[model samples]
Target: MKKRQRKVRLIRAAIQLVFFIVAPALFSTAFAGVKSIFQAIAAGQPVTWNSFLDVTGALLLITVLFGRHFCGYACAFGSLGDAMYELTLFIRQKVFHKKGRHGYPEKVVRCLQKVKYILLAFILLSIFTGWYANLQGMSPWDVFSMLTARKLPNASYKIGIILLVLILIGMCTQERFFCQFLCPMGAVFALMPILPSALFKRDRSKCPAKCGLCKKRCPAHLDIDGDTPLSGECICCHACEATCPRKNIQIGQEVEELKEEAAVSKTPVKREKSAAVSK
Candidate 1:
């Protein structure tokens, strides 16, 4: 299982590199195409609306069907964050002899989670108000474009550099920090619940008692300890499933036992007279 997980990660890394770096370099306008559509809509321009549909519509459909697998698997910016995080861990352990990894406190993380929603709201507001440029300076996609292509924005964007540095530090210290707390794009996907069932799930019946490994490995710190899978927060990263020692976790959802429990609870309990009373 470990070997299989490793192979999956390697393949994912290759795909991210090729699609993000190689594909964009080879084809002009490959990067930031989606952003352009949003900008066009915000500006009320006579834009090639079909191109927008071609890109983001597909992603939105996939998000609805499978959850945010795009973020976990295909997003170039996500891959960059993961790389920064791993490099930070390597440096910390090898140089400082740190025995364990730590993330933001649960309280802090929860508070931070709300930020993404706020950001999403703000982005929507900007779009409706035709103020898309409000986010232009520090847009992560634009920063990625500048970094990859060695092209400067038409105007100076100091905030973009500053935000990029902060993102690197955040990723290094906390797994998927930006995705969890600040990515408006990710927020859009997360708002839409996946159809039928999430693409992956945990079997609590088979899960070992007292094993919190899945929660610890989860980038979103989702509550996988429950009787049924809680997947709204899940990013489809499979980190939790991979780290499970029992290998009980699997891809695809199972009908929750909770439904049966609910049904049983709804039936009234029968009361029988005591035999002593009858005698």
Candidate 2:
């Protein structure tokens, strides 16, 4: 790894460690503060502006710009998945490999995923349109807090167990399952379907054969050989670029840089001369 990338990965790993340790303890308080902030802002009540933004807006800002990497790398549940995954990998390698693995019911993952998007829309609408009560009742953070605090009901607790099971399943398969599939807070970030200012664009001209290095490294199952990933399903994990033996795969600062370089290389010298004369 380059020095800068190695440093970033190390920093990300450290932050993930801290979040894993500290967040569950703080989740309830975070819930209370965020609710208060949202209520204050929605009502246009006599609330300090700093306090409102600190609670309501700052969290969203960080989550949206950074991608759900914050969840995969910084969330408490993420740590749980990571720790469990290594053990599970060992067990499965030793035992379960011969017995075909089973996936958790995708019904809940796909259908319940839609529920978060709907809930997210409602929350934003309610917050902006003076109907804060609509959202306040459905905040998943509150659900998460209540579950963690041991105040959730028997049925709810069962459902939480199912969620935990699903999370484990995701770790064995996709690295960021809850963040990718379920968390309503993550719904906001996952919907930010923009090409990264910098991205791993396959150089088709240089790459003649169906090079397989990038795809093999991607945990998300993206076919990098095909084109830029269209599903917005990527977490910007650069494992593919890292493992490319051909070294054709790289993280670019912008798509434009690759385009400009391609254009410069392909242009005829006569065209440049003509353009210079015309100028």
Candidate 3:
């Protein structure tokens, strides 16, 4: 617990320094975004809507640099999902004495997991149409502001109840029911088209018995060993690498030695076949 707390504190300090102190833009990056929107409105010109570009750029910057560390380290929803996972583990171990029946086939689970990406598209469409304009009452940001300011016509008891219920359901589900099954942000990060991006790739040859322990640890339900997993389903949680006893996994650095060894192995086999043919 101390180690976890220490690591979290160090990471928090880094975030405070980089985001709050040195570059607030590093965190929000919402400066130019809000500016452009308001500027366009002031000029009475058509505003380029959809700041997904900014969000995508930020995601890529973080992903290429840190290998999905944003999800593991910074994202609020991801952090909440991880907390829920811990809660679920506790409930199963202490309260119930066993896990929920590992329901459904692996293939079915993987298939159903694709729903998140589709839902992400729906969110984008809804945003454009202002489908959630009514949700201002339910917004957490609004609630906090209202509470702090101590003035509101409707404080939204219903919204508070709804949020709590959702959070509870998310906590109790089999696996990140909210993050894995619902979060559009998560879906986007997982499905980021460009992949590998000069990051640390798995050394398939280094595994004893070529055991796929890394794949087993993946909460995003990715085959970290079988494929270069840059899918929309992958959260880059690093649970797989963390579970590796051999420390064979890496994040943003490639295993060039392994690549060279693989190349040498292939060359020797080809050379042996050539020599046999000559003989």
Candidate 4:
């Protein structure tokens, strides 16, 4: 189980690195598609198929089919957040002799998660009102995109650079800080009507009473046992599945198989107890 968990993490990290280097602008590109549609609408122009639509449509289809795996393993900003958080963990553990990670209060995190949705609404309103055009150089993502493309931002990007710095600082303090609390793209993904079969599932009956190892390990602090709407905010990182000591969380065919195995394992104990009572 440990080996499998390590392998999953390694594969996810490698995928993240590849996407970070080769397609770091994917999130921004998809967002550009959304903006173009609204801008066209605001201008009374007919929407036509373009690269922006192509990218946006494709990603939305993928999210509906496979959950938010893109956010978990391919988004460049998410990769950057992961790197920053990992560095913080290293520093805390090695230099300060403290715990490698910190868990925020669940209530606080839940409230913070709503902020991205509000931001998304604000951005859409700006675009529809033509105010987005006046808000140039104010997006942290714009600064990140420029820096990743090896371009030095100009004076026009001062606000963006400042926001980027603050976001990076937040990233160091919390795992997936941007994805969890600030990313408009993440908010869009969360609102997607993802297929239930695509979302990870947990068998609460198999979980030890009072055990919340999976929730604690989740970067989004999601409740894996259906207490929360699993498809709403899950990024499909599978952290809960990997961290479960009972191996109770899974998706697809694996879920049914785990239940069968559990049933089989209990049959003998039940028979033994029955035999002892009869004797």
Off by over 4 Å in 1: 1-5, 23-48, 225-230, 255-279
- Using all chains and alpha carbons, the TM-scores for the candidates as numbered come to 0.77, 0.57, 0.62, 0.92
Task: Check candidate 1 and list the clashing pairs.
Answer: none
Ranking by TM-score: 4, 1, 3, 2
lDDT minimum window of 10 residues, candidate 4 = 223-232
lDDT tens per residue, model 3, 127-165: 555564454465432342344345552745568446645
Candidate 1: residue 221 lDDT (0-100)? 74
Candidate 1 residues 1-279, lDDT tens each?
A: 678669767887787777776643211132234456666777787667565456677777787877777778777777778888888888889999876666887778878888988987777777768776666676655666777787766545777777877887888888888878887777767776677555565556666788888777787778664223435567778777778786656565553654354346545432233544566
Total backbone collisions for each predicted model: 0, 0, 3, 0
Lowest summed lDDT window (length 10), candidate 2: 98-107
**Which candidate's lDDT is highest?**
4
Instruction: State which candidate has the highest TM-score.
Output: 4
Task: Encode model 2's per-residue lDDT on 54-116: one tens digit a residue.
Answer: 543554455445433555565665555555655565677687674423234444444545655
Off by over 4 Å in 2: 1-15, 22-56, 59-68, 97-116, 119-162, 169-174, 193-195, 223-232, 255-279
lDDT of 1 at 191: 75
Candidate 4 wrong stretches, greater than 4 Å: 226-230, 253-258, 265-279
